[model samples]
Target: MFNLYFISQSTCSILLLLNFALKNVACNPVVRTKSGCLKGSIDRNIDGGKFYQFMGIPYAEPPVGDLRFKAPKPKHPWKGIRNATEEGSACPHRREKRFNQSVPLVGDEDCLFLNVYTAELPRNSATMKLKPVLVYIHGGGYVFGNGGRAKYGPKNLMTEDIVLVTLNYRLGILGYLSFSDPTLEIPGNAGLKDQRLALRWVQDNIRRFGGDPNRVTIDGESAGGSSVHFHVISPSCRGLFHGAIIQSGSTLNSWPWGKLDGAISVVNKIGVKAKTQKEALDVLKSLSAYELVRVLEQMGITECSNDWQDISPVIEYPHEGAFLTKSPIDILNAGEQNQVPLILGYNSKEGHWMNYQQMAAKAMGTWVAPFSWECIIPWQTGIKKGTAKSKRFADTLERTYQTETPEENVVNAWSDSIYDVGIEQAIKFHLKTHLAPIYAYRISVITRLNYLKRSLNLWDKPGVFHSDELGYLFSQSITPKVSPGSPEDIYRRRIVKLWTNFVKYKNPTPDDELNVLWQPVESVDPIKQLDIGENLTFVDTPEARRFVVWNELLEESPFIIN
Candidate 1:
């Protein structure tokens, strides 16, 4: 992500006038921004109306060579105007070829680009007024994702009175490896820094795009939600955004620095070592990016399941006490994080989407694909051991998701025990420190998407599955196979209303006939689960039991213990 330096309005207007004059005063043409902008084309098909779109705007310089693992640096100022009408390249990552699904292809190392959508062209001085900003971070387990993905088109989101911003960040080995030298404090989590840089960029130039930097709301799902959790605690991210929305993912998957020893060992297998931290960093940075990815793959580093070997943020080592300090939990506990309004939540049946039984059957029956071979076994076994804790944790889970043996049971158990529980912990932490209004929900919209619904047969899993709410919340049409009668249609409307309401008012209360008031999570009887389905309900009960079981499982007997 790009480092940002904000110049005052006088400076901004002067820059604007100069840019406008350079362009010969085009019709409501958006002048190139400081990071360098290009005029966008108008599209009538988007958002039920015509909207202006600017794609592939660079937020940071490329993270290649020695800059790979360091904090993102600002892009060098451009001279002539740059073309941003087309989407920019996505970051480099190992692509997974899936059935009927075209995987997002590889692009470039300098993938810190963004796309913007607005109702109309900024009409000169009128567009300079501050409008609320909605900055979205995409989700891919911190390993795969880019803002270029079509699922996140901002046409509808932009139609509202909000400025929509979407971005891409470094992923995989390129983003999260921790170099083992004490002096090389900045080894891991360059991707997170990339996110902060993007936010900083938004703060600096969003006004030019008709957005209020101070009223920005950072939002995301899955890994992106985890990113929001990190932002809540990160000192570097303190002033970058005013509100946050974490959907379906949290920092529960995060492992402390010491837990990464195994991953560090693999990173060292390239026959490169150093006496000091700086020397170590120099040696690692010197290796080509391909060479680094190759070495991590060869050593079974990248093969490990997501939980056992984490790519999530940790307090930066060496600089842990300094530069990048505090995990989400730490910040919340100390009451030191940004105490802004929040909408943090998860799905009711988050694990059903993984389809652990099918994955395990495949892993057990065949020669695992290189990626699957390395990832499946350890991940499956890990979750099984942890699932032995509670009946609700075990029975309810296994009933919906069946496995041949105890091993598969462990895998499914670990997935929920680790992931779903993490969100619960975050909720508890937020309540401890934050006095601001907190709205939480449990996405219960069971999709008509037969594939996802069929997978739910493992047991009678309820209304929600991990990410099942995305399509609905974004108002994406349901699959033709999923019967979308009145019930399904109403479910879609409710989710869209909840999300858009949150974006507009910093709360999920919608101004419609189907509206329902949501209560803030507080010290007493803190759990608030909004069942977002054909019929919405308010569930007020403590969500701590599951948290307790899962936390214990993580502490005492991790299913995927390294």
Candidate 2:
């Protein structure tokens, strides 16, 4: 009453402070990671509840300049809050077939990023339980996949009491090039190292996002699935994840490991001195990231080898950072790896996805695309295309698995070689070595929306092509232009329920939701394989006959199948 103006100023100051306090309260979901404080946006669930969404969070420093082709370094800590709202750039890769070759491509070199999705929290609730975590590594044959794609939204997945995490690592040349030097200089599998670092990041900071670090599960499909297999054996990933879900990719697959010469040849074609590794390294270091990728593209050789290999993970040279010094099959056969719960399985028609016409073209001496099978080694092994040795291998393939037609034979060869046989070997080895709960399933569900039905010829009358389960799993993996709640949608829900139940509870069979029981893989049980479809039908291992031929070949050969 004595000083009205002073009273008004004091009131304004109080209002200002109240506004600031409210702002801080509104940002209650902010997470304090080891790197820095992150301010993520919130999204409304289908149930009209809000959940924290942290996107484009840097897990490792950008693999640029000196960091390129080297193991990933942890990201430095920041002083202030980082806005993690947008998705990160995908690692550099060759865009699939295009009409215009002249146009500049997409992707970036600074792509070591991860995203986290936490379930909706109640207002001012401290009793909320930490959720189980699933960190997924995207697969594109170690060449062309990004974790931030629109199709992989965590909306449906997050509905369960699970924290979903997805991440990107280096790909193709920047990821898989092996200098093959003993000094650990350019030790191959940098991409895999990137994945390791991302896992470390999750282990370090997932708790801040209300995730139980101890209950982390690593999962992937195709190349991503192989990555999961590698983690199972990698010492660096020992305590990072508890359970692994390998879908449609066996590390023992004919793919994944790049031939030593093939990686060198890729570097040589980039206008580098082919005389020595040092010279090649010098030239590679001097070129810009985009320039290097462009040169690789113009050369018309996909990655290091053909699509089957294409410069993926390789046994690292014996050194400090060596993740794998010998073949994974040898180590697993000897029972040397981190013992953990595992769910290993493959799609119904994992091999029918590859084009028979394209393979026939390459075998018939036509260069259809950059990654044709011509550059392959063991099928020829620098012995020239028409040599007797090459012919013998091809002839052996025909005799190994007799099919209706040559085209069918080619598709079947790819199917068995790339996925079925390899998976069988891994399963057989797992049975021999580890006694932990190892469950294997044959995903024989015939979906209404078969991805490969229209794309590739169905000479084999395959029930489901590779990655058809992805549509039922991830909302965005495939789009059939059909609305949800179809037969496929119901199956998708069933698949998700089973998968998430495994994550929440170790055994997928014990869940009370469905009366189905997915038993652990066994030698005596003929109907151990879980056939996931409209109804749960227990069937014998579907790929038994194919494995018989493959087991014999794998046992005799010292070198891995090429």
Per lDDT, the best of the predicted structures is: 2
Best by TM-score: 2
Clashing pairs in 2: 151-476, 377-381
lDDT of 2 at 6: 30
All candidates' lDDT scores? 0.60, 0.68
The lowest-lDDT stretch of 10 consecutive residues in candidate 2 is 372-381
Q: List the residue pairs that clash in candidate 1.
A: 382-559, 382-560, 383-410, 383-414, 384-410, 384-411, 400-458, 400-459, 444-463
* Model 1 global lDDT (CA atoms, 0 to 1): 0.60
Model 2 / residue 559 / CA error / Å? 5.9
lDDT of 2: 0.68
Q: Per-candidate TM vs. native?
A: 0.77, 0.83
Off by over 4 Å in 1: 1-29, 45-47, 96-105, 124-129, 180-185, 254-263, 268-291, 294-307, 318-323, 356-415, 448-463, 475-490, 510-513, 523-526, 540-562
Over 1-562, each residue of candidate 1 has an lDDT whose tens digit, in order, gives 4211233435445544654465443333344577554556555422356556778888888887557766778888764445557788777755422111233446578788988776543445354666777888887667666776355666445446777888988876677766545555455677888888888888887766777778898999888888887787777677888889998777644322223323444445556554554554556566665555454445332222433553445556546323355455556778987888888887765655455434653554422232222132234234432343433344444453354355444444444444555676677777887977888777655655322354334435443555666655442333332243556555655565566677677877745556577777774243666765556777542234444444544455343212
